[model samples]
Target: MLQARTICATVALAGVVLAAGAVPAAAATAAPARAAVTCPTGWGSGAKSDSDSTATPLSDIRTGRHDCFDRMVVDVPGAASGDLGYSVRYVDRLYQDGSGRHIPVAGGAVLEVRVAAPSYAPETGEPTYPARAGHPLPGVNLTGYRTFRDARFAGSFEGETQVGLGVRARLPFRVLELPGRLVVDVAHTWTAGG
Candidate 1:
């Protein structure tokens, strides 16, 4: 009788343990689901411009790649945020600012970036950002970038500097003016990471 009781106890303990585990497993299966990923909206492909101008000449050009977009930054020394002006728009073709010569860019679409600051120092008339002779910007490589195909310095003339950004297509883009910098970002696609 004692052996039979022990066997019954073991069976009873296993049943209780299984019931407890089943409750927690069911609760875990009923947990809430996660939200889906959504891409940013409202940034368009139209022309973006600001009328503000700065006497501080643009000194440098740089670029970066991100998860959803590619970026280009123009450095303007001694200029405050929102003090610099820019006109960023998709164009059929890119051309030199002063010479009006056609600039051949490599991509399906071209972004004409016009900053309202010279690339030269006004005091000494020396180039702060030197000319590129239609070549890609120094140190900017677009080999693995998702949005950018090529970038060239179009020209700097009459207190304005222009750059040609060759992109994969006419994608949405935005311009941001930070302290002493003008930034342009081109989205990879209509949906983020698509």
Candidate 2:
């Protein structure tokens, strides 16, 4: 009877150990939970603009995704060369600058990004940025972005080039002028972790 009781106790101990080991294995296989996103404040959705103009040519346009916002960078001559003037405003509809025709943009809201610089070389008038009106901007892919849905070239006429940004909603956004880039960041949520 003593031997039988010892065997039963050992079996129970082994069962407990096996169960404990299974728990860790199961936990290791489970996917990790993503952390909540915290966003910045004071970036309103109304309109952000700078009147400073640049003689430097518009060279490129690019996009990126962040934890709290989606970013659009407009490449141009460095600030050392000249300051870049930009007008970024939310609009009901986007229109081509030179032709005044409607430019189709995909999203719940549109931001008309107007850079106060030409898309062509000033001296030779040769095109520097090949984005055309009423079409998707070259090399810009908005896949899997939380705030940005699409980007379309509105037009480039005179000294300014316009591009339309389509976002999920009229979220808060801010624009910054860096050394050789104009950065536009649109928030993913209204408040922190929202």
Candidate 3:
């Protein structure tokens, strides 16, 4: 009985040590640098529409403003069924503020554009393109927005990829691919007021 008790105690101690060592080393790394940007009051609180599509109610939209830009959260319906690949990123030269300052967004105006293909996997709930390999299909262009640039696959948090854009204004945007929807959350930047 004495020997068995000692063995159990030793096993428990080893388990604790192993668990402590299993933590990821990257957790100690510094966070990415962020900038301070402002959003208009109630700016992110309304429905928006794309020229090619109708307006969508702003339910899933979230407010985000960074050093040189503001953002919108595009919530996708969990039960949505479609053959579209979607992504979001910042765009440059899409719109200009009052001071003519081009908005510095992460992706462009066509942030998070996804094209659905026939081979999309239903089980995993992720789009797949054979010709593109690890990337999604090309994105669409916004009419009357000359500064709104193109879109491309970019790195993101949690090992996922997002579509990036280069825009001219610090606009908040959301894209709903299921019903072919896109919403731009426009707010007057603080700089535009003064």
Candidate 4:
């Protein structure tokens, strides 16, 4: 009787150990995987979108061709209750007077980017278009398509500004705005390949 009881207890302990070993395997199968977002052709990488009190963060973004141009839009949040105002549009040229050089426009596709926000003035209730800082704006390029020539910010209109990229054909593209910056990536796809 004593020997039989000892054997039963050992079998129970073994079963417990086997059960413990199965947990991690089950967890590995149960966890969900994250999906990766990538850009299509004529787009760059690292695109994402978000917002804050001072600015609405828009980056790594792209839009399909509508009419004659591709449109990229970004929203700028107001810092205070009435402290936001701006606009955006496309232009034919972007001039740099200090360097005395003109950035050549791309050939195939025309890109138009715009931003609209309110002006921060203590006295005026009317909205005014503020000048964009002459700093470098975001850029987009074309890949896998020879028709694409180059991309650059053309200029601004009223309050809207434009960045133009030359492209040969209108291809599928994607845009992303990650934290602190934005990106646009372009890739080619086929029906057979995943």
TM-score of each: 0.79, 0.81, 0.28, 0.35
RMSD of 2: 4.4
Off by over 4 Å in 4: 1-5, 32-72, 76-134, 137-157, 164-170, 173-194
**Residues 65-162 of candidate 2: C-alpha lDDT, one tens digit per residue:** 99889999999865542388889999999988868899889999999999998889888999999877788989998989999999998877888999
Can you give the lDDT of residue 143 in candidate 4?
Answer: 42
Tens-digit lDDT track for model 3 on 112-186? 332222223444544442223223223333434334433333322222223344455545444444443223433
Worst 10 residues of 1 by lDDT: 34-43
Please write out the lDDT profile of model 4 over residues 119-141, one tens digit for every residue.
Answer: 22224433332323342334433
Regarding lDDT, does 1 or 3 come out ahead? 1
Global CA lDDT computed for model 3: 0.37
Error of 3 at 151 (Å): 1.8
User: What order do candidates take by TM-score, descending?
Assistant: 2, 1, 4, 3
Once fitted onto the true fold, the runs of candidate 3 whose alpha carbons sit more than 4 angstroms away are: 1-41, 44-139, 155-161, 172-194
**Clashing pairs counted in every model:** 0, 1, 41, 43
lDDT of 1 at 181: 95
Instruction: Please report, as a residue range, the 10-residue window in candidate 2 with the lowest summed lDDT.
Output: 76-85
What is candidate 4's local distance difference test score?
0.40
Indicate which candidate wins on TM-score.
2
Best-fitting candidate, scored by lDDT:
1
